[model samples]
Target: MSDGIDDAKRALRAELRERRQLLSDQARTTAEEGVHRQLDALLARTDVRSISCFLSTPTEPGTRSFVNAAIERGIRVLLPVTRIDGLLDWTVATPDGDVTDGLFGLPEPVGELLGPIAVNDVDLLVIPAAAVDHRGMRLGWGRGYFDKTLGSMERCPPVYAVIYDSELIDEVPRDVHDQPVSGVVTPTQTIVLSPQRH
Candidate 1:
């Protein structure tokens, strides 16, 4: 069963990755703007004071604007620093801050490492995903970094996955360790799953 799930996930990831790569530059920009708008509205509606979010890579739905805007609003932002042991460390993100090369070509903050459990301090958590299902299951990049982090948390805040609208599906293949998120933030809407079935 695990093998079947893994194969299915790989197939879905390839399909989504291809679709993302094929997006036209103008379309990608428009989609990114929509994402920013939705997230901005989310900020307005909630009293969340702190969040842990990812610094998006080029092919992913852009989070740079959202991260910057969050910082501008005086919201504390924590970015992940991938470690050698398949766990992640946390670091504060600043608008003018630069990132250093880290694992998997991720650009990590060049500040103090707040250890692995720093995520417990956030009011909310934002994560990156290749695809998400309607049930709020997120398909990550097969590294399991976020999965490990999510699984270890004793009491977690609302966790959201950032993805393009089309990436949300009816279902995604699941492994035993797969963690479901509380909500999803797409370019067009923010869907919070009720009766979260994690």
Candidate 2:
């Protein structure tokens, strides 16, 4: 990653984080519901029996409702648990599962700790992103956790980033280690982008 592109990504992530923080309560509610619908729509198109997803922070597009609903539907949902080794552990999401702040203060489920490779069996992946460009490039929050997970997968499933409608932009700065998603699920719609090859 060039210093120029890295700097651009840092600035863009900050702006996107600020935008999320500024959302009104009503707007957040609506966006949360919209996210639920879009996620359901994504599931309708894919034949996933199990999936991997992140638990969103309050400011991010909400996924908690959908997680509960999926659990009710008997789908195995793996929630990411951050490990200190720069890899993610996993836990099965239960209805009303206990959540504690993991590394970087991200919400993580508390349960049986599955090893890092547990994600490999998931039929789909719904991850978080600061922004996703039209061509599927994902700009994360600089931790590189999701990027590394995707990169290490032997046969990655259809990965999608959850973002607000406006965060879907024309382009985003990228580096060699950045992993492209197969699509994006926004409050308004689900867009399939051509995933880039490393």
User: Which candidate tops TM-score?
Assistant: 2
Q: Residue pairs in steric clash, candidate 2?
A: none
For 23-138, candidate 1 gives per-residue lDDT tens digits of 98887787778888877887787788998988877788888888999999999999999999999999999996788789877767888899999999998898999988878788
Q: Which stretches of candidate 2 lie over 4 Å from their true place?
A: none
The TM-score that candidate 2 achieves is: 0.98
What's model 1's lDDT at 175?
84
**Candidate closest to the true structure, highest lDDT:** 2
Local error of candidate 1 at residue 57 (angstroms): 0.7
lDDT of 2 by residue, 1-198 (tens): 899999999899999989999999999899989999999888878978999998999999999999999999889999999988999899999998999989888789999998999999999999999999988999999989999999999999999999999999999999999999999999999999997778
TM-score, every prediction: 0.95, 0.98
